[model samples]
Target: MSRTEQELRQLYASTRGMPTGAAKFAVLEEVIRHADALGLVEFAFDVRMSATSVFQHSWAPEKAFLTFSWCLAAYDREPHRFGSGHEHTLLWQFKWMAYSVYQYPEIPLQRGTDLLEDMERRYRRGGHSMHAVLQNRGEAAQFTGEVERAQAYYEEMALTRRDALSDCAGCVPSSQVQTLVALGRDEEAIRIGESAVRSGCTEQPQLIYSELLLPFVRSGLGERAVEAHRAAYRRIRDNPHHLGELALNLLFCVHSGNLVRGLDLIERHLSWLDRPRTPLTEMEFAAAAVAVLSRSQEQNGGDGGAVLRFPTVEGKRRPDTPAAELAVELRERALGIAERFDARNGNTYQSTRIRDWMDTGAIGEPLPLSVFERAANSRGGERLQRLLDQVADRTAAGDLVAAARTRAAAAELMLADEQYAEAAEAAEEAIRELDRLGLTADAAACRWVLARAYRMDGPGGSGVRALRELLDSDPWGREPQDGGPGVSPEAPQRLQPLPLLPARPELEAALGQWLGYGPEAAGWSLAAARGFAAAGREEEALAALGEALARHPDADAEPTDGVLADLLGETGAVLGRLFGEAGAPGRVGERGPTGPTGLTGLAGPADRAVSPTVVVLIAYAEHLQAIGRLEEAAERLRTACALLDAHPDTEAAGRRSTVLTDLGEVLLRLGDVAAAEEFARAALALLEPDDAWEEIVLLGKVLRARGADEELAKLLTEHGLELEDLDD
Candidate 1:
């Protein structure tokens, strides 16, 4: 084998240091040096933190960016060969420097401009074969919050690809698609993104999968987004270039009721990042940490929850206890590694969205009027003014708890300023007010924020516990007005966890019991079961189902008993199929498909109960189904159906025609020809005279499943279909 060939292989060796021995390193270095001597950037990563990084950078800034790029290539060659600390060393010292400068002007950015432009100009000669340069430019612009400029760059890149046939490879046109999305131009983003998925021209698996994935996520596309994401994952199964993208897509799968997909994505991302020689990245670890942390926070663990820690050194991972220590660590690292080169830059995130949330706590007390005065002059306008007024009134009325809620609105800015202690204090203060006012839900939410801040600052077992409780509780639940402690019995209603959810009597009852507002835990338990029943968590869904049945085994019961029986019977059918019959295990066709036998099984009982979250999913799923997107609709169904099988009871239960359409589709797919036809016939029967366009299509699906598509299509054409047609 050639010497160069051997060195390339050695570059990714299992045991560490440089991945290659000195001789191999020398050969590879010589090769890259030859490329650099000709002005080619073999790789691009930051190198300022290394012993010679600063010297190279200070001596020649342009050379530094290139050298850093090369170092990044080496790190990429086998990043896992290095430990997370080592990668963090390089990541902070160099990789992120570009963004730090772009986002925070306080950091030096002037030095890297020339290098950026150079990469651009040279690539432009190849008829806009400059996606890398354009992509970097987008990163830089976004980091600096130059939104318009960033959008322009990405748009131009997409346009360039369109005009040049050869340009269509690897990166795809994700630039325009996602940039438009981040800019809030969702219609165009979806139009272009979905098209790209169909075209299959994209080779950058990360970019393509993201394009495929976005229609569902950051969107109401519902279940349809599942197949798109899955298709993208399948496209890049063995492609390392798409590993990071693969990981997040998996998350999207999990979001859409594809747990297997989510878990597999985790493995794919880990395996790629875990390359031995360079060492898998700490970024992967940190991301995984966020995922776990996010879930733990969701658990509302009666006592235990996830906690976050900041790095002791500013750019490092360990969060040194005490602000002073962390600050000192940060300063030392900052002094040495702070960029004088191009600022930190990336996709829309600049950093991870998780980082943004961390840097800006979302639940602290309101800013003083002075802060609002400035905010009025800044990005926050009406919301800030309104929030300030509300907060002010609360304080004047001595309603500390009410005032605390306002703090959540203002926490972002305070957190941005690194006022962790202040944030913590405000969260705690709000919790006190809620507690004093006997507002359990409000208090619980405040605790969620407080716990987050506490965790961000240091150790956080207590914080995790608080977060867990909030997650476990029914945020949308309401309480009675007859009488309550520390609150007026006549008070209109208590704060619901999700303010937008329309109130339901049972939901309110369930939440009240969970929060210990008044009723015995039995009500909460019963309501929970009802919710699960509505959601298709049969066993839990039927806890109340059984009670309703047991109320009068014989006929001639009271009117109230009859009403309860009717409600329970309809809901009971769902519950029985979902969790299995009362004491038995969960049944098939009851919930979303799980394992091979348990499509109807719960995502685990804790998450199997009912929730208002189902309403949102059902609406979204129906919309997608109407759009000639059966696959997408199925995915949406999978997700919302899971929620349905879990929720206690719903106001706009899936009995609606839209939900019927979805159910009919699922039953047909599962080959329940008789049941599928039954559901479709019922949905069709909803209209006395004429069927709506969406319902008509749903009828068509029902017929198609029964091998009657030809007859249905003829009838539809004679009648005309318009459910998904915008003009109709």
Candidate 2:
């Protein structure tokens, strides 16, 4: 092989381990340039082909056109030199090129239409099915406001059999679903989407979930819509490539009375609008953000402003801007982009769609997205009546298991309503019926309700004992094993862990609060986290902690004299024993005399514990990092660090470094190399000449970012670590 070829191979190999994003794309572009300069025709074609995919996944898919055009021209001049494989790849890329053509007004409508016809002719000549060609035609027609034509093409595409050239199973249906929804055929869209989700696809559920959000809401299936939003948002929240898809979810939040949540989504992803992958996607996202921000502005009497954090140099923060101002700005940008598309298409279609979406009003009523929120926000009498109706219907049908399950559900609602006595009674009846029917899972759920009721109703420690007994008995007949928490073999997969999910987390948090500072409290909190993790409900878990924080003493206030002093003393004694680095080293609550509110002992010089708020905030940061919400996670970690900075406590002081290290890692993920380096250095400065692996690893990221290989090697040698040790 030639030296140039070997060099190209080495460059490609080095990039294999790099992540997919701007950096990788830039490197791939460089490789293409090198191949072109070295007079490697086929090699340059190969590199450009890879560059096209990288472009498609990056924030500028339209940028692929230049490289793709070169490849197309090369193939047309000498098809035999590249082989059938290259021809097929070239034809497939033609589909993307055709779609991209409509994204800009600079490319005329005739250009897109001609490209579609050319794609069809080539597919026929290559002996390929018209499936992919028809699909692209339909999408192009849809973009150009030819809904009827789009529908006809979609119908024809559906009838056509799949071939190696057709889009993936999930993708075609997702596109069709979008077209159907636009054509006022929501039910049909939902039908297609439901089936597609059931059968699965390469991007199953995730891609289709966003497409189905509007359909489900339009069909008055609000609960299902909420579930789709949660699932879709979780899947796409971390992916910068899914900005357009995430926009749909933001609109759902607006229509469903989740104004705060809509704002949260906006805050998390608004930076994506800075450089949207395509103008079409940018218009969609801006339209959605306008809708959300406008509604939020009205709700706040046009006074509340949202503080959005954009990616900035040196961890600099963006200024707080009013919702109305941001809304107007986004609205103009969206309308302008829409006008460009419409002008290009010689119609008002794109602009009208953008205006309609921006001005869209909420549906009849707000939909609560979580089980607990639904139960809590629902009207007490109406919700109870519905649960009772279910029980009556199940009983009349002679479905005893169903009736018992309904009763358990009703009991949960009753607890939320504070009807503790009636809830406890209902729970007992359900538990007996389920146990008799040999439904261990159902029975276990009822027992949890009963335990909760026992706690809320009266007898102190009754709820605690009952929960302990239930856990000890191993109601699932197994420990949490393989994959996640195990359930009884007979238990339904959907109902694993418990009946009311979010309710279980709430119960765990309550149990932790009731126990106060001890091993039991920490255990309960951990259990709550595990349950939430198993359910893929990170937001709800953090929310549960937030609720717990509210219930605890005024953590924001300093511990002075009087009641505050005594409270702190009591809290400090128990927390020091339970959580401090150097304590009695026995069971929590083993030291000190019993005092006010069941707290143990008085605070002394030896009892300086970290603030509970700081601890929980740090934990929230960690969980947020795990779920890919880097910016928000960094915010929470900074909050924790600030709290530590204010107090300067001796207990768990290493946590300050841990928080800084975490913030630095999150900055690294966000591509703020300078900010990441600063935080890493701060964390390292806080350390007292210790070789803490996490801090060292964070510093290593800083060195590597600067291409300081010599410095990194020396640091590693000094710390007795290796490059591999710092990976991941």
Indicate which candidate wins on TM-score: 2
Task: Give lDDT tens digits, candidate 1, residues 539-625.
Answer: 444344333332222222222333433433443234334434341333323444433222234433443234422333343334334
lDDT of 1: 0.43
TM-score per candidate, chains pooled: 0.30, 0.53
Off by over 4 Å in 2: 1-4, 304-316, 370-728
> What count of clashes does model 1 give?
70
lDDT tens readout by residue for model 2, 1-728: 23477778777766665556667778787787788778889888888888887787667787699889899999899989788888878888888898788877678888788888889899999889999999998989888999889989999998998898888877888878888989889988988878777555646677799999888887899879987876665456555678888889988988788776677567647877767878888899999999998888777777755544332312334565677888888999999999888878888999999998898768859986533334444455876767766666777899886676677777777887887766765676566556556666666667777787877764345576556556655545543322223122332221212343224555676677767753346556555644553564544443444433333334222433243333234333333433342332232223343333332232221223335445555654454455465676676666556556656754354777887888899888888889888888888887775756788888887888779999999998988887887777
